[model samples]
Target: MLMELIFNLGLLLIIVILLILLSWVWPPDSPWAPRWRTKKETARAAFKLARLGKKDTVYELGSGEAIALMVAASEFKAKGVGIEIEPFRFFLSKITVWRKGLNKEIKFVRGNFYKEDLSGATVLYLYLVPQTLNRLIPKFRKELKKGTRIVSYKYEISLPLEKEDKKNELRLYII
Candidate 1:
């Protein structure tokens, strides 16, 4: 029994090490955008542009640490979903949501945001770079319904803007 226990522990340790290494190496081929935490001011601007309501479901792509998700849920009283590719940030955000008692309002999923279905989202929030935005335009066009709001910080989407906040550098588009 002692020998079996030792062997099991050694195998567990090796599995843990492999997982750690895999987590550290960002998937280059995947549409895994870099981590960019949106500032409170910027998040507020995007939320305002979205005009969120109780019925609204806000989905934040590349939601690093879920700062924007927290703001949307707490301030705007909207249901928020955050998708993060990075394992560390995903766990951190999940813990934060639980600690804040915002788990009812906010959800953090550890997966590629590109594969997530955006059809149900009333407001789509993004802080992605120009390349990612361009790449996602077709997906957005295919998935989003009419009157759905899209708020992008820093990088602009190829679509015509419904409203632009020059101060915060945010662009709002309606699908």
Candidate 2:
């Protein structure tokens, strides 16, 4: 019994170490990866853009771990959809939404955001690099309905005619 216990403990320790190493080495390639932990002000700004009426449907592109989506779903009482490419983050988001009892209000999609339809969304949130935004500009213009609100963190795209709101560490645009 003692030998078995020692072996189990040793295996657990090794697994923990490996997980830590992997987390550091293979950090998620999120545009807001460094800011995985949401700040109060950022969350407030995102919520503001959501304008979250009960009828509003909000979509978050590249929603790493779905933290922002969870908050939006709970605070605004709006339906939230999140698309995440990373499998690990996707699973984590699924668990979080389930544990928060937000499964009904929050949905997590494990796939690329560019392929998803945005016509149904009234509000959109993104924290992606400038290049990614440029690539998605055409898609947004084509799919998003007029007057749909878009809130981007730390980056902005060149749109022909769009409104911009510049707050500390954030930017908002309406299309």
Candidate 3:
């Protein structure tokens, strides 16, 4: 009985390690490859720059691991929708949110952010490249409501800059 228990424990450890390894490796081969999730401190600073509040619903593009959304929900008490194209990453995001008891505040959609309807979002948080940001400008202009806020990490969006946290490499804009 003791040997069987040890084997089962070892099997569980192996499975946990496998999941961790898979989570660290980029699963997508497209432009979203080498997923760079915004660091926790950086995400907090970006959300603060955007002035995210409890009433806001922040939508994140290429939300690998949904780190920003998790921070927004847990730290700022805001709701969020994470758009992740990779299925494995999306699954991990869902699990993370669930484990953190933020499932009620965060939702994950395994789809292209460009194709998703972001009309309901009051704030947009993205850490995409400049080219992708430029491509999404048209969609942002069309779907996002007037006075909508945006918090971009590293790259600046085309919208008028409202605030900037240069130390954190974050930019805020209003649509």
Candidate 4:
């Protein structure tokens, strides 16, 4: 009985340590973390609100799993670029896009969203924390061309609001 108890304790300790390490590298609550997935329904709503359509270049900042980009490419007939900083998420998104045979329509970029050029983007889709949104204010001003459509899920941008989907909790702005 004592041996079994000790083995159980050791197993529990190992699991706890592993969890700590995982959380340290992938903190779910961190503003910069890219684990949160914007649902497909939400993506569709946001894309529709943004008026995304054929030939439109959409950039999804912190695009987890690249689901939004896939939706844009498949449903809205738009081209997309998904930027992800997290290594594992980036790899997963890259492979997923390739496996889904969307390499022609969607591109997965592994880098900082701020560093990625926005000049070519006609639309922006963001599902990020408020802190990240706040930090991007200047980047948006500097990089995004006038008339670029921005759709932010669950957070408001400082730009003038052009449209909103209250049910989906999304906001849209033009730069």
Model 3: per-residue Cα lDDT at residue 94: 93
TM-score of each: 0.80, 0.77, 0.81, 0.84
Candidate 1: worst 10 consecutive residues by lDDT?
A: 27-36
Taking the tens digit of each residue's C-alpha lDDT, what string does model 3 give over 57-77?
999988888889999999999
Deviation of model 2 at 131, angstroms: 0.4
CA lDDT of each prediction against the hidden true structure:
0.84, 0.76, 0.86, 0.86
- Model 4: how large is the Cα RMSD against the reference? 4.1
Best of the two (1, 4) by lDDT: 4
lDDT of 4 by residue, 52-120 (tens): 999799998887788999999999999999888878888888888889898899987788887888788
Candidate 2: where are CA atoms >4 Å away?
1-37, 160-165
Measured with C-alpha atoms, the lDDT of residue 10 in candidate 4 is: 100
| Among all candidates shown, the one with the greatest TM-score | 4
CA lDDT for candidate 2: 0.76
Score candidate 1 by TM-score against the native.
0.80
Clashes of 3: 0
